[model samples]
Target: DRVQIINDGKFIFSDTIAGLNKQRQAFNLLCTLLAPPSVTSLQKISGVTAVETLSPSQFCLHYQPDLNPTAELLNLAVTQNWQLTELMPEQHSLEDVFMNIIQQEQESATVEQII
Candidate 1:
């Protein structure tokens, strides 16, 4: 499946399957979780605006904004094994800019709100 990454220049937010605690998974059910922490720490830099997950493990990160491509970031990509890419938005809406990949199945229940 093609993964969608929603983030600005310095922050990323992704979706996580609600209640699928990674802490309590077997050897297989647990997906390979990725985050900026392991990347940034090893790379050595600062500032995290946000972090989210798509599905249970897939997520993205927005590197430092308004700074020269730091050696650390490059090293992070190489060392941490993070595949980097640039995303261009068709719309500039704030919602579109800053949203995680929430499940439509969960959304359906919210739409069916009963009073």
Candidate 2:
């Protein structure tokens, strides 16, 4: 099905379900390691935009999809003996997309008001 998202009388997004699914700023990965690694070290990897520690041994990495760093991360995990236990991609639902678009629009409006 096709959907269009509007915010403040402006069209924020217009596309099909598949199209919306493909529109993501970054790819999010959840990784669980037996041994914890420094968050700063993970942030240094190319394509990695952000690193969030869910726990001492679990981390969420956000990176550009076009420059996926999964291979590099796996190699580093092996070399550092992090003992990677699990790696999974985060999937967003349609509701998540709608909320994100609305949040973005709100943020943009706030920026415009400030300026």
lDDT of 1: 0.36
Could you estimate the TM-score for every candidate? 0.26, 0.67
**Residue 99 displacement in candidate 1 (angstroms):** 16
lDDT of 2 by residue, 1-115 (tens): 8979887788998898778877643498899999867899999988999999999899999998787889999999999999999998887876887888899888988999999
Indicate the worst ten consecutive residues by lDDT in candidate 1: 22-31
Least lDDT summed over 10 consecutive residues: which range in candidate 2? 17-26
Stretches off by above 4 angstroms in model 1 are 1-45, 62-72, 83-91, 94-115
- How far out, in Å, is residue 59 in model 1? 2.1
- Candidate 1 — which pairs collide? 14-52, 14-53, 15-53, 15-54
